[model samples]
Target: MGGNQTQTQFILLGITDSPRVQMPLFVLFLLIYIVTLVGNVGIITLVRVSPSLHTPMYFFLTHFAFVDICYSTVVSPRMLADLLSEDKTISFADCMMQSQSFTHFAVVECHLLAMMAYDRHVAICHPLLYVTIISSRVCWQLVASSYLFAFLSAIICTWCTFGGSFCGPNRIDHFFCDVVPVLRLMCSDTHSSEMVIFAFVTINVVGTSIIILLSYISIIRTMLRMCSAQKRAKAFHTCASHLTAVALLYGSAFFMYLQPPSSHRSLDKVASILYAVLNPMLNPFIYSLRNKEVKGALVKCRRRFFNHWQQRSVVSSRT
Candidate 1:
């Protein structure tokens, strides 16, 4: 199809269209979005202000929190809007932008998790080399590469999706614009497009998953050889949090994207909500509540903030 002949707008049916469900759904999602913002922002602030969190692990965590915030923001606002709106429509350009941004940050997070796993592997398996291996420059490079490659991958996936013609029914069943849901709306054959999506997803999902698996294998092997039970317990405790996050994120993502687009529309929508909305909101708690270091940092940060406020109050009273 020619450029001028392509689709201009699309109707998003969203999770549902029932008048009875709108307000309840709106309220629920609005609260979730608020929590997502506060949680992610809190993690970023904690990482920035706490000197104890200046290590490589927290360095990657800061970026992960950033990605979570960006990813949730991409989907949540529009989703919240659609829940309350009668029409629930989005422009082609806007839909494409959402897909691209969502995919970019999501992929960045996938590889970032793998990188974090590798960081743990080095820390436990080779503590002597951890500092030299995961230096400040290398941390920057890992984060930079994640964003760079994820952007390129996002472009490819977006192109493959939008390149097809959308002459069929313009109504999307899901809450937001996604490659598979959008592909289902296309009048053109989606064989090539679906194949491209599959290949990219495999690389992004399975490829990173393999890295994480291998890293953990090594970490486990090294931990087993440790002389002290305390060392092993501490190491496993650190790994547990990242593993939980990876399971929640990748489990929902794989369920949503791995299968054919035509399968389980409602189920897929719910799973999408899990990863896009709930996961990000829960991540800060997962990392902070489970990890002693983060908890300590939060306590320290809180004290400093409270003391600063107290000093400011006293100065204002004197003035």
Candidate 2:
């Protein structure tokens, strides 16, 4: 590392420098963060309480919700705070920490989406073997592997990114400490770092995307051969939410990271917000609204809550 690399802090140029927009953006993102927490927590609760949803599909879904919650938390709070503050500075260690968590969740999400697709394939194509194949042990293994791989990728990518000398501009062009934005600040030669980032991103993003695409292709084939229109509709309906979630996440993520860091700086910053903030908030609604089981569970839980409240109210009145 050099003098610049050893520098303690960097300024983050947020989405907009306009004073008028900061407060509005803060309020908006705060609301989004709250909703994100409520929705994801609701989904996890529903999955836990509803015995009907105690299957492999919802099992993966519960963890997916958890990941979304974590992903959003990592980026949103800091962004909100920065939006309110004029300094908008982040420590070098904090910068690397943000990058590490961001990369970890992003990579984990890619693999998890692919795994969900595979779970659907097994359930749809091999109905009888679904239970046998995607068992409790297998599900844990899949999740564990997703985390393990993501952790490893995070370690390598973060090391490569922060290992370089950031002896140049201390002002980052984008909002958060994303790899591309921070890389632009480094004075050291980053050809090797860029290549390493590209390779890891290719595997985590492009590779997982290919697997998801292939799984969906097989799923389509299996659906087409089915004689019953009702069954076909049911199948499509079941996978619709997952597909939407995949599109939102993958679309934004690829747009943010897959291109030259210098090109589309503004657009990339916006895309980063979409991928990191909005996507996580939207995921729970996407899954829960479209999912009948989740809806039913929510209704049941609501009824129980009201019933218990009424009982308490009556007792209080009597006392």
Candidate 3:
């Protein structure tokens, strides 16, 4: 009887209790998910169809779009579903999978963004050697390295979190299967696990951000030495988009993971939402709107799509 009561209480407490915010949160997340899908898919299609965007920079951009789609898909659908459902229960296996997928994409995004910085760095600092430096082989290697890093990070994180014993209450607060929320539900001592998570987060977030910063710093110094206002401005314009992305990603991640868990869980959830949902939705727009090449590609793709639709419509009408 005691065990049964304990289990019942745990289940009730573990489930999401924020009923009033459910509908509003659901609608908000649904809209964001739609926007994320459209923006990322649009970017992927534009990059693929546009011959002018076949270069390395646009290659990385396409990968970023793909990562964004994966990242948003990892968390948003489940989150949206949880909002509308009365029982916000996720199976232990499902939770672990969600956690792994989320972590993988999140880490991959960091590396991808860092690679973007390196690309800009090469383009700006070694304009003459840009082609030689970021060759097709080198680009593929960097992309593969990013994926490997993401996978390793995810493995470590999943092993750490899933190793914990969740005897009863399996409810994860917030929208998705984040490390902290899952750790909180653990019945075992999670101090060491949390520390390991913090260490990995630091390495992935702070470490990557530092490398990106150094690359950009070197690029900027080299540009300053060149003293060509037009070239410097152009480099800055290109770097600005990447820098914004870095700031959003690292800022949120560092804030969420670096702080002590007790005081900052709510803040972490909000910050996580920004990068997970908002960043993905914003990335394509930032690139397309600000980048001349991307904008041209997007415009060309749109015209083609519209023309194709019109042709189909005409055929249907004739039929």
Candidate 4:
């Protein structure tokens, strides 16, 4: 923004301008968006109804799922709609809203994954103190703090992103209003804004990643010291799923933010899709399919639902 001559709106160039690909891309991502919402929401519901899943691990997981849904929604809906509509124009106010909202949830996801790793670490490495350490009160405080940190970080990031002049180049190359893409459009110097946003991204990604790495190291040491073979296997199995999600999420996230803004729009867009779209959609499956406990909880919930429905049907027939 020129502070005075900022464009009122922007035209999003989207994934592709070709007519041949737009419909196909629209259908493809629409399905992904559906699965992201369903899978994340379903996980939240499963945790609530399943008593066995009410522990510190699932507590963090519930919030992670929520963040995934929210962050993905910040981009996917608008992107998908733009795929179909001839006009992909978005107002300056709307672009800033999208940018800030995405930042909020993205920070939330990073911390929640780190928190989940810590929860597992306590459960495995310090089993005797797990109950005392990761108590209900502590878990809630962690979740609350994650949101608070995200809120503050997003405000600063959004402010810095639009702090420069955008009097020219009213077209954003990507499908959505991401910080880097929008930064490239600025008519004014974007070095300060890019650095500020990069610092925030680094702190959230690398800082949280360090916590996860240390927790896993301690957990591995504890697992090795265990005398029983069965306990070690069980611990490894539990850690595997969390590691998968961490890789899927952080790999793209680091690729996107840890470096300077790229001139290659295609590479940037692909990285964005991985963390922003694919990560959220795949998390529920990754977390659930790998864990025996989540599977067992799902079975119990299904049975309970069927039983309740049967009871209602029997009473209606009697009447």
lDDT per model, in order? Answer: 0.90, 0.89, 0.80, 0.91
Predicted candidate 1 versus true structure: per-residue lDDT over 1-319, tens digit per residue: 2253267888888888788998898999899889888998999998998999999999999999999999999999998888777878898988889999999999999999999999999999889999999999999999999999999999999988887777768888788888888888888788888989999999999999999999999998998899999999999999989999999999998998898877856788889989988999999999999999999999998899899999999999999
After superposing candidate 4, which stretches have Cα over 4 Å from the reference? Answer: 314-319
Model 4, residue 268: displacement in angstroms?
1.0
- Candidate 2 local distance difference test against the native: 0.89
Where is model 1 more than 4 Å wrong at Cα? 1-5, 310-319
| lDDT of residue 37 for candidate 2 | 95
Model 2 regions lying over 4 Å from their true place: 1-4, 311-319
Please give, for residues 1-319, the per-residue lDDT of candidate 4 as tens digits: 3365458899999999999999999999999999999999999999998999988899889989999989999999999999999999999989999999999999999999999999889899888999999999999999999999999999999888877778888999998999888888888777888888888888999999999999999999999899999999999989899999999989998888888885444798899999999999999999899999999999999999999999999999999
Which ten contiguous residues of candidate 1 have the minimum total lDDT? 1-10
Q: TM-scores, in order shown?
A: 0.96, 0.96, 0.89, 0.96
Q: What TM-score would you give candidate 4 relative to the actual structure? A: 0.96
Q: Model 4 misses residue 65 by how many Å? A: 1.2
Estimate candidate 4's alpha-carbon lDDT, on a 0 to 1 scale: 0.91
Segments of candidate 3 deviating more than 4 angstroms: 1-20, 303-319
